[model samples]
Target chain A: MDQAELAAKFRNKDIKAFERIYSDYSDSLFGVIFGIVRDREIAEEVLQDVFFKAWDKAETYSAEKGRLFTWLLNISRNSAIDKTRSKGFKNKNKNSDSSFYVDILETRDKTEIDIDVNYIRSMLGRLKERCVKLIELLYFKGFTQKEVSEELDIPLGTVKTNNRNCISELRKLIQT
Target chain B: MNVEEYIASGILELYVAGVLSEEENRDVHAMILKHPEVREEIEQIEKAIVRHTAALAPGTVPSFEFIKTHTAGKQVPVRSLQSKKTYSWITYTGWAATIVLASGMFFMYYRINNLQQDIKRAGDQNIQLEQQISDVRKDAEATEELIEILRQKDIVTITLGGQAIAPESFARVFWNKKDEIAYVDVSGLPEPPEGKVYQVWSLKLDPLTPTSMGILDQYDSDNNKIFALANPNQSQAFGITLEPEGGSATPTMDQLYALGVVSAS
Candidate 1:
């Protein structure tokens, strides 16, 4: 079975299941939260809180509802947004700028990660500006199709097909 | 459903993002399960998003031990102080004249409370026994009334033979067409598997439509193993199938234990 399928069958109180899920999805989840919170320590704290919520509410998670990643993403986005609004996080970073995920990647120069920064940057350069904004708004910011349509001033119908094409391109890039 | 067209619609990406309405999400989820191509497409979209985000992860996660301890430790109940107290009242205390007097008074109070509780408990038990006797008598009267109803001249007896799945198990159905009631006897059938009960179906075999005629509950406790059910349909056949607890919407053909057809009356 795939990692998504395995992560859905968590034993609520089992530390082994919690450990396995943490190891599997924590990096992606941390990245998503970190993308929003933009602070390592605050993002990490939010990430921990997200998993604790997941562990406590394991019975509510089911494969039939949505993918395990989707479930965790929802939790991470809500928690990080809530953190950003809090007094502590507001004091640290007040400016919520217009930089998308692509901007975030361009600034980070970590070699230890499997991501070949220059190669991905060159490939992502081909992905349109609108595609990055759509992903950032939809995935990172948790905007609905209606909200995205209003934000981008594009027809709602185009938002869907454009995302499909952009993700397909990203899939090919990542697979290679 | 056109798999290619559906996959190209791009709702699966939104689905992976978890932004769709619950109803919309369920529709996409059902599509993923129904079509292998849809599931593959959804997995690919999710992988792309996960990988893209994971590439930008800030730093290494702390050791799993921190999370493990936090999650595991929080559920543990605090050891209440009451749990630690030793109730060994027989232990010796300081031997003083005042201590002896105090002990005598404490013993007298304990004995009075204990005797009073014992008397009250005995009275409660006697009342419970009397109530049980009355309940049994009521049950006997109900059974006698049922027997009388079954013995009426209008009652039509139908013997249901065991199906291939359970050849040893069979049941009898007594129907009163005028009253629109069917009395089912399941004494011959063995106990149903755990979490399963025998559901009776009133069927019309021309187009093969089945209507539920209630379930045969209390299979173990009934002395005669007979249950009365409402059968408002002009049933051509009677069937019993083992179903999950609370019964199923339709009869499970493989688990059909007994089936019998009504006479052409």
Candidate 2:
């Protein structure tokens, strides 16, 4: 089924539709959560929470707001951010090394699962450090353009154009 | 609105990021309906982001059954009631007493199980609370130390005002010139983007030479956003520039975030 049809069915509390949505989007959602939380166990818990929240709040979702995947992505990101802010999470990770999602990708254990790690690595490798950071903060970290500009110490006016250029670079890499 | 220009404006990227305001989102939504190319662009952005993020997923995901059970819809079972059959008063009383006795035992068992679970949950909660208390205490102690450093009598304070690029941004350098150490208060600066660090430069104005003091590598993790770096330069001024991670040998002029000259002390 198309995303719209699946979303509509999922909204109607159709179990099959929910299962299909979970199968299709759960991995990406989990990846986004894992990127933020950086712990497998915590990421799993947050992943479950994201889906449960989505299930409970399905009716509030509409295509007018955004795509179904984007809706789920927002939930996952918010939940993961909340997890990181929790006192328990803070205490546990106080001494942990600060690493971004790229680090996670680079250091992934290859024995367990099959993914095109080399493809990802090569695709990401083509972008400059600035582009990588921009993509990470804007797409993965959900930072606003102002925040991205402030974070990168780039001109506020140039953030949108810079990001557009970066994503364009990414598009070329993906296409090739 | 020109469709091509709107597409090139990067509003679609912001839309995918889910950071646009509701009005902007509605506008984009309207545009998507009106233009197939716009929808295609959004779809491609969404696809690229999804694939990129999905690559970072851990080796395993939660079991499907777990989600199924948790998100299962509530359903009320239907039951048909049959016509009541007349029974002797003594038989009905006996049956009622037996049922009451059985229910009493079952309730007691269920209560004990629930209480046990509650006790376990409370114990876990107490441990988490204790951890939180310790973390907060540590944070307070760190903040106190930072305040002490900021208040030192020998510290020479310089306010690094934001440049034309970031008018709202600012930072402070509390340098103990005698000790050759500078404490940077970077709270005013926004958190550094990934793969980027705010590199402080001890500058000489006459010669326009820049010496890298140190990179604020732990900018995000540093709760106070205050970092202490060794400054061995016979510096006339201080400047901070956002450099790529690991820092640049020389500050990128355009990326210079804040700058301030030392008072003739």
Question: What does DockQ give for each predicted structure?
Answer: 0.25, 0.24
For candidate 2, what is the DockQ-based docking class?
acceptable
* Residues A91-129 of candidate 1: C-alpha lDDT, one tens digit per residue: 333334636544455445422233336654755587777
- TM-score for predicted model 1 compared with the true structure: 0.54
The alpha-carbon deviation from the true structure for residue B211 of candidate 1, after best TM-score superposition, in angstroms, is 64
How much DockQ does model 2 earn?
Answer: 0.24
lDDT string, candidate 2, B202-225, tens digits: 999887999999998877567788
TM-score of each: 0.54, 0.54
The candidates score, on chain A by TM-score, as follows 0.83, 0.83
Tell me the tens digit of each residue's lDDT in model 1 across B1-265: 3787688778899899988766667888788778888888887888788877776577787778877766767655678665565644454454465699999999999999999988866754554465456558768988889889999999999989999988988899999888998999998788898789999999999999999998766775567789989888999999999999999999999999999999897
